[model samples]
Target: MGAEVLADKVYCYPFQKVVTGYLNKYPTPLEKNVTAVTTVEEQTDPATGIVYRRRIATCNNIIPSFLRKSREWIFKWSILKVTNIYLEEESWLDMKARVMNLKCRCLTWAQYASMNEESVYRESKHNSNWTEFSQKGTITITGAGYLNCILERFAQTFLKQGARKSIAIMEKILEEKYGSPVS
Candidate 1:
């Protein structure tokens, strides 16, 4: 089984400012689960003037109590690794990320559970002063033998709940930093 999520939001801030905020959003109170962020690579394409960045962020495990013990045994931690491509000329940013269990070299369950997400940000067509952000993601659970179906359902539920909370908190942060949309 597979699950997908789509979210769209308009920010009053200009595209540049919105991009800045997104790059600096990790340390905010809304994302306390994130423990650290490290930039692994960065470069600019001379031909197209596009920028590429790769980052790895570590997050504390926040799984359900029932899964905590198993999670701890199979995975030492959770890490999100992402690559972002920015096209300033087009005022667009694209991101692809993978959420994985750290230290899972010899693990079975950990290999079956993973999360992949992709997102895009663009200057609003309605107004250049506003930015539009959209995200689409999928969560998958497989290779768990007989428990695959149950695990997939659990992952879907967990991700849905987390996404709702995170979006609410992120909106509040954006409002505080850029002020509410002039609507």
Candidate 2:
């Protein structure tokens, strides 16, 4: 078993603007951990016109130094020696429906653990000028035999923190691109 998180938030901007901001938010000073982002694949559904995109983000390793003290574990898993980690994101945008869905997961440490996240942005039910955003994340550590419990907790916290950071980045991007908040 692992930790799971769920959250809901409202972006003051309308769905269109919010989605635009979300897509453009990257390489910002506020989030230095993410070094670069590249779009690897893109396709458009001929019938529904939904746009699908796959992107990979290269990020500076965020693992705490204390975790590195596990020399034997690190030695055993030589893959952990790398300095940068990769995150894969797939997003589907339904232009007519005004919704965006995304799934992001870890690619660098998949052997040792699994961190998967799903998120969505849609027109707010109450206000057309606002967007509703929700996300869920789950983290499970498989390689860390006994310390799995503690490591899972740490990873869960990290996952939530990453989500919060993205929200902040989106807010800033919206403000800069579209000016003042709608409401």
**lDDT tens digits, residues 1-183, model 1?**
766666677767676666766667675667677656566666666765566666665655554555544443333442112122111111223322211111101012345565665666677778877777666656666554555566567766766775676567666767888787654
Q: Which candidate leads the pack in lDDT?
A: 2
Q: After superposition, how far is residue 19 of candidate 1 from its true place, in Å?
A: 0.9
10 residues in a row with least lDDT, candidate 1: 98-107
For candidate 1, the per-residue lDDT at 131 reads 72
Show model 2 residue runs off by greater than 4 Å.
73-75
**Candidate 1: residue 123 lDDT (0-100):** 74
TM-score of structure candidate 2: 0.94
Q: After superposition, how far is residue 117 of candidate 1 from its true place, in Å?
A: 0.5
Per-candidate clashes come to 0, 0
| lDDT of each candidate versus the true structure | 0.55, 0.88
lDDT of 1: 0.55
Q: Compared to the true structure, candidate 1 yields what TM-score?
A: 0.71
